[model samples]
Target: MLQKILRIPWIARRTNHNILQELGMKESQLLKNIKQLKLKYFGHVVRHNNLERLCLEGAVEGRRGRGRPRRRWTQDISDWLGFSVREASILSQDRDGFRSAVWEATSYSYKDPP
Candidate 1:
């Protein structure tokens, strides 16, 4: 889509990185933003003692299906923060700490062209 917008043909051999650089875009901008938002929302939900939190924590029991186990939302949060879901939940209690952790977890640093 970007290539079409830029009128660059496939035969031009223009790399995606080059195109993104031309457009002044960080490659991970969209993904990073999504991660940041997800983390922040998770923190919000964790701070509350509601149905949402219970569901997120897998406290609401239900039947399991056959084959591979489904991945949980907290798993993604744990992967991103390099901490267990329980620890992350505890940290989320501290608003400032959670915010800083989310920022650090999702931040992307773009290197200047040489």
Candidate 2:
């Protein structure tokens, strides 16, 4: 779709990375934004004693199929921030600390422009 918008022909045989470089697009910007949003929402949910928080805390009652247990949403948070969900939940209580942590976590996933 971006190629179509940029009117770049396939005949040129340009790679998506090349096109993105030409356009000066930060490849990981979208991923960074998504991670930041998810983290912020996580903090919001953690701060509230609501249904969403319950679900996030894995309070759902259901039997899994006979296979490996499915990864929970909290797994991604753990992977991104290098902190266990419980620790993250505790950290989220401090808005400034959580915000700084989120920024630090997402910042490492992208490169600064030269």
The 0-to-1 C-alpha lDDT of every candidate, in the order given, reads 0.85, 0.86
Pairs in clash, predicted candidate 1: none
Can you tell me which runs of candidate 2 are displaced by over 4 Å? 1-24, 109-114
- lDDT per residue (tens digit) for residues 1-114 in model 2: 568998889897888878778888776765777899999999999999998987776664686689888887889999999999999999999999999999899886445643
Model 1, 14-58: lDDT tens per residue? 998899898888768756877998999999999999988878866
Using Cα atoms with residue i matched to residue i, what is each candidate's TM-score against the true structure? 0.68, 0.71
Instruction: Name the runs in model 1 displaced over 4 angstroms.
Output: 1-27, 60-63, 109-114
Task: Please report how far candidate 2 places residue 37 from its true position, in Å.
Answer: 0.5
Candidate no. 1 TM-score = 0.68
Which model scores highest in lDDT?
Answer: 2
Question: How does model 1 fare in lDDT?
Answer: 0.85
